[model samples]
Target: MALFPPKNPVPTPTPVPMPAVTKPSTLPPEDINRAKQLGTCIRARFAQTLVGQDNLRESLITTLVAGGHILIESVPGLAKTTAAQTLATSVSGSFKRVQCTPDLMPSDLVGTQVFDFATQKFSTQIGPIHANFVLLDEINRSNAKTQSAMLEAMAEGATTIGGQCIALPKPFMVIATQNPIEEEGTFNLPEAQMDRFMMKAVMTYPTAQEEQRMLTMLTHLGSDTFDSRTLTGDVVSISDVEFLRAAARRVHVSDAIMKYAVDITATSRGAGTKPVQGLSTLVRLGASPRASIALTRIGQANALMQGRDYVIPEDVKAFTHEVLRHRILLTFEALADGVTSDQVVDSIVQAVPVP
Candidate 1:
């Protein structure tokens, strides 16, 4: 008998007709121009502070425009924290950074009721979670109990304290960073919490040329700390970010593109009527409906950034890895074989027919 029994083959069902692609709404030329300008300014500021990792920069901007949260994973010294902070500083919004640790408590994140002896009353003191842009640095270092405290805020844009629900500041977004190289004193984020993030950006070491440029830039700056305030001319207000987000929402998405995004996520599950070959053996779980929704929204954001008013297949393909990398759960065999989620996503993307 085989170590893992692989017996049944799923017979393909008769194909159902896909819905007709409806015309999508288009953004005004002025709005499109504004989006392009904002994107360019943000990227330019990022370039001044960071050497490379263009993809990571784009992912951060895309997530911001899509009104979604992002999770960044990288080894130490990759500038993950710097990238997030730079993006936060680019916008004129309240920013807070939480250095997560095993001792962090739920009350330390959300607010807590404090007794006001002088006033003879209790007051609700807000925590760092109330900021417009919140960065949870080294999130995995915190215990699961402390991590659970973020679920409500991240999912509903509100946090509960002492039976009172308080809304987070407008244009709220969470940028979480985790170190993949460290496993000791770390807790694995639950799947439910992980799904809350719209995208997971994996950062890698920069190329030789990029590293050399970084050295020269830092040496010229005369210090290791890079001040984002130097790009004051490029800073955008909260209203500007809201405008770009509205533009992204208006960017048209055809039914064909919608289906294409859904198909890519579905094929990963091995639960679809027509499953990809060997997918079931490798994947223990697949992405949720949220993944499909994220793909569409991020695609719209990407389209707007590229000076287009409508999403295209290329828009959907551009960020497929970032969108689905964290959602898929691999089996033991796949891990033993050293297969990665990116490889799995590539296979699924290839298997699904492009619209």
Candidate 2:
């Protein structure tokens, strides 16, 4: 006892408690109505600004309501990035845009551990991926490593760093863009990257009348004064998205429609003798099982947007092109015959007998 008492005893410190993990809250019925109203408002606002790009506007709203990601391929100066940010801001969702370059790093996306000089400890510094809505602008311009880093966040909905796993904010969606006109020095997305998207939307130029309207608007407001976002009055809150997403969950999908969805995806496999004569010859790689799931989810969202209690075959058909366009890889023969993936998808739809 005397020998032990001579030495000072060390005291143990209390452990710091970790925060409790909780699931994201659900949206109430009232919030769902508000979300639908907000979707209409944003769609109208974007349509006026984007000019004759109704298809693109529909794609944006559909993808957002569906809680899915979209990849847009278009020429430059079409407001692709601007539209993405405006959509995010219009919905009160935090927007982050990453202008991809060849040298961007993974830390530039999922964040990194930074050493605090004063605290003498490493602190976590989150990157752009933390936002509710993220746009990887010119995604193909970035190298493969950067692309993979982005895909990780999209696929897993979380990122691991420094022996810790962090979940992204709920209702997270990624809208990446690619410039099709530019072939030089652009890193094409691999098959894996394409599979992650729910749709591939192509933005075409405005029609003659729409272009005239745009020019008139430009002349009247002037480039310096015209602000497209000004039209998006009464922005939708993120909570509204939560409610609408909940509503989409309640939308009924019948067994007949379920079989129809499966058949569409199955035809994409290019296996077995089907009504479409050259179906297997056209595709080098067909849609996967994920496409089937996406088709159904997107169908439900479409029905909900239309104020319907159940999904119809038309809902599946409406989104099939967008769902399968990016997923199909046309064979050399298909390309040689000028048979676009869109055409092949149409052929498959025609071949498959509707239940």
Give me the candidate number with maximum lDDT: 1
lDDT of each: 0.91, 0.81
Q: Clashes per prediction? A: 0, 0
- Per-candidate TM vs. native? 0.92, 0.87
* Residue-level error in angstroms, candidate 1, position 139: 0.4
TM-score of model number 2? 0.87
Among all candidates shown, the one with the greatest TM-score: 1
lDDT of 1: 0.91
Ten contiguous residues with the weakest lDDT in model 1: 225-234
What tens-digit string does per-residue lDDT give for candidate 1 at 82-185?
A: 99999999998999999999899999999799999999998999999999999999999988878888988999899999999999998999999998844566
Query: Where does model 1 exceed 4 Å of error?
Result: 1-24, 271-274
